[model samples]
Target: MNRRLILDVDTGTDDAIAIMMAGLSPDLDLIACTTVWGNHDVDTTTENTLRVLDHIDHSDVPVYRGLGKPYAPIPFLFPDYADSDRTIVHPHDFPIASRTSDVRATPAVEWLVETLRAATERVTLVPVAPLTNIAAAITLDPRIVDAVDEVVLMGGAHALGNVTPAAEANIWHDPVAADVVFQAGFERLVLVPLDATHEAIVSLDQTRALRATGTPAAVAAAAIIEQRITGYNEILPTGAADTAPVHDALCIAYLLDPAVLDVAPYRVQIDTVSPLSFGKTIVDVDNRARSAANCHVALGADATLFNDLMFRTLSEGR
Candidate 1:
């Protein structure tokens, strides 16, 4: 009994690794991919998704383009960051001679509604990007919430923020959207926030160890990971040496092997009122007031087991 999943993502290098992990998993069936805005612009994200699919020989997977920006007006400021200064590299640095295909120009909301209506089995919406598309979909039809089996999102943080002082890139990108989805009240939800992902990093040694697998996907992942880890080194002053967080990959790993993670159930809420805590995920790890638990969050994970699982997936994917 394979779990059917639809991955809505903004294919960052970490996203690519996650996709590869999902593709290789026998228990998790990846039915589709939807591109969103995060690590790069929506257009570039879609291109990277397609390129990675091609590289991993999984191009048959349908990729739908998602929301380009937030629903409401947002104050925009161009921040001078080291990661921003790095050259934008497509998944395949070399362009394919084949003409690029046009993405689903229609809104991600439409696709979500249509896909849910058509799904016979419960579909898990694994959104690893801003919640704009999912938010819009639920807004279109409130009943759409019932159609989903679970939403295993890779965003937010109970602890430190990844983007701003109190926000992860995905949640921060569209707090309004995140608010909508959380309020929709899906029955089964699991948020793989930064608290766990921040603790999970694949060091340069790990990448070198993986590069020895000799799989095309592994080799490509190693190369992209090399760029990411190097970027991290140049951007942040890290005392523990350099590594990529493998943020999105952690979500998929937990999906495929729940035992790899130590999860704690809790009542989840998103704080949108505070300027600093706007997109913060307020998860009551302790059963305070004995309210109904809304989510099962990964509190701790076995990093060694996770990396081993990732290596096995990439090796078998070859």
Candidate 2:
């Protein structure tokens, strides 16, 4: 049977691609999408999620609006990136003229608690944005931690950071929530951090091939990826020229094919107190702490396999 999956997102460019892949993949049953604040405000993210589902003809997938702010206010100040031209923070240019559906009446945290409590089968939770909603759900109902089959989240980094020298945008946005989720003791927690995603970069030429597929999902994915490439090149240039990491989509790729990532067990902790290192995922790669591993942190990715799965899935549409 296909794995039951729920995607929690911020509906930025990369998150949009992840949603399309999950919504269209035959290997997964996408039960719903939960939106939160990260790359954009919660309201815009919800609208963007609707836009993606409508464009891909997957309107049946329910979306629930979640928290607009962190579980608690951030104690320290950080760069807002409001002036940055990065596409990840701005609204995506999907072909859909307008949103076709609204989010469900139930708040995301409540829906998560209810759904997990009532689920007869374990569900996979993929949170690519901030951990606010997921953390809130767990806080509300700690038993739901056992209800989840696995969590493949797209955030954090070992060697480098996207938002700052010490943090990725998602984790840095709300370290308290990330800390709660990490220490919640889920049986299987997979971290697809920048280390893995940067390795699975997509180029402008590859997007051209995607657009040539002539499917709505493929075309929209191509446009979104191109925007990412432009943003990355202008802001945070990757190892390769004309290529950019579709960070959130790599989490979906790992689900479709576990081999897409090279992972290892590690005791990862979030730095919540240090002003300089706040939101950083301190992965004990050397095992100096001698702590039992709580998370499977992805350090590498197979670009060829990722491209193959993503290209084929998005090209086929829903």
lDDT of each: 0.77, 0.90
Tens digit of per-residue lDDT, candidate 1, span 1-318 = 988898888877888888888877878888888988877778888888887777777877778888787865445442523135334322335222232445656566788898787777888889988888888888888887777888888888887775666777778778888888888889788888887876677788988888898887788778777777776676543346876577788888888788767778888777666765666778887768578887888867778878888888997863
Candidate 1 lDDT (Cα, whole model)?
0.77
Off by over 4 Å in 1: 75-106, 237-239, 287-290
TM per model? Answer: 0.90, 0.97
Q: How high a TM-score does candidate 1 get?
A: 0.90
lDDT at 60, model 1: 75
lDDT of 2: 0.90
Using TM-score as the measure, the top candidate is: 2
Q: How does model 2 score by TM-score?
A: 0.97
Candidate 2 wrongly placed segments (more than 4 Å): 82-95
Model 2: per-residue Cα lDDT over 82-148, one tens digit each: 3354444344454445767778999999999999999999999999999999999999989999999
